[model samples]
Target: MTTLNTHPTTAPATSAAGGGGSLRRVLWAAQILLAAFLLIGSALPKFAGQSDAVRTFTDIGWGQWLRYVTGTVEAAGAIGLVVPRLAGLAATGLIGLMGGAVLTQLLVLEPVWSLLPAVFAVVFAAVAWDRRAESRQVLRSLRRAPSRTP
Candidate 1:
């Protein structure tokens, strides 16, 4: 089906890619901004052994290794968010990360700090919802790929 503003050939089976190009652009922009923020404010610090990251991880009682692991996931997810095909899946994964962050904040750090992850969770949910079609398409492709095992 085609609307006056959209052609089936030009659009995908997704809202983020089809009917509302403008919205998709906004979402992309948001994702880019968030990824930049995560890389600079969170991921990089952990990898760099910054004092704040060190302190936070120490407080969490999960050891420095957990900091590295969390940073790795955050960095990967941030990078994934910018890849058109991976945004949905990345957002879905980030939502889980954010949920864990929220719980950690409440239980380990400070209760007030949970707000950040909670807000991130909501934003990720929006991106995941918007890109659901792309996520499904990727999954379908994986399912259709021929097995390589001999």
Candidate 2:
């Protein structure tokens, strides 16, 4: 039998525009930076009841409970974004969160503030697209797992 190609069918290692390797590295750097931002800048402030975060959430008028929930989601997503297997999924989830953020800014807050989340959504979308192959593989494996029914 022929040997299977273990490597993903990604772009060439070296190309005219720098290379796929550099692209991957760039993605990794962005992921790490974004993860750190989510954890330190957003999640921690919400959890700590920092004045700015508190006031923003208070203005949202959904109660402090929503702040805790959003923080928890951001914390979990941030952690996932650094994991190779989970990065794509994390980005996918974060995209949804960012979409919610954009809508919240447009509807509840100032419309111009929506630009921030819109930008975040674009980045997360890029990360998600890059990791699509891995995400698909994970889904396939999950589909193949045996049921635990008695």
Candidate 3:
């Protein structure tokens, strides 16, 4: 006669890697990489060449200064995303900042290039949403009463 053990397994299965914490971490890494690329590629150029970047800034007038401000914001947000405690807030700020970028491109001028900022905005928003869900789950688990073993 064989006895069957009904106890739940304590260890997480390797196959579960794609489902929870691993998934969150992977998404965070991708978000950080994308943010860095945007900050470097567009923001850096703006600060490096005020006249050229201001041409794109248009009616805003303070174009040169605005370029510097946007560039600094992007650089800071990029750094924030990599830090464990600040990742969520960083992602949220990124989403808002990118949204403004996309709107500026659309309303100020119908440049085909405007789509790139829009895409980044959407991607960052999705990353923020995912991280928010994970945080909520953690908080919920913490608040729940521990299970009693019979």
Candidate 4:
């Protein structure tokens, strides 16, 4: 379906490719911005052993190792978000991670802390939704690949 733009500043999608391209660009921008914020604000601190990260992990009683692991995953996911084909998978992983964060906050910490992770999860879900076709294609390719068994 083509999208009709009322304003001259934005051109309407003339074909399926054009519509998909426009949508993809929009989703890509959103994913990049979100990934950058997460990587810089959250992942770097954990990797660097910042006081706040240490304190939060200590409070959660999960040990400092989990913080490092979380940081690594976040960094990887953020990197994946910038790759056009990997954005959906990246967002999917982040959604799972954020869901766990939300649960941990709700169970171990105050309710207020849970809100942020919950919000992040929602945004990740949106990215996944927008890239559903690409994600499904990847999955299909994986499923159809020949086994390497000797």
Candidate number with greatest TM-score: 1
lDDT tens digits by residue: candidate 4, 8-109:
225442222345666667766778888887799989999999999999999999899999999999999999898756778899999999999999989998
lDDT tens digits by residue: candidate 3, 1-150: 997764333333222224667776677668768867857876787778756677877665554678778888888787767764455567788888888877777777666767987787777676666656444544566789798999
Displacement of the residue 86 alpha carbon in candidate 1, Å: 0.2
lDDT by residue (1-150, candidate 1, tens digit) is: 875755333665346545576777778888999999888888999999999999999998879999999999999999989987889999999999999999998988899989999998888888898888778888988999797997
Error of 3 at 1 (Å): 33
Lowest summed lDDT across 10 adjacent residues in model 2 is found at: 9-18
Output the better candidate (3/4) by TM-score.
4
Cα-lDDT of candidate 2: 0.87
How many residue pairs clash (N, CA or C atoms closer than 3 angstroms) in each of the candidate models, in the order given? 0, 0, 0, 0
Residue 83, candidate 3: Cα error in Å is 1.5
Better of 1 and 4 by lDDT: 1
Point to the candidate with the largest lDDT.
1
Q: List the residue pairs that clash in candidate 2.
A: none
| Model 3: per-residue Cα lDDT at residue 42 | 68
Alpha carbon lDDT at 110, candidate 1: 92
Our tally of clashes for model 2 stands at 0
* Position 123, candidate 2: lDDT: 85
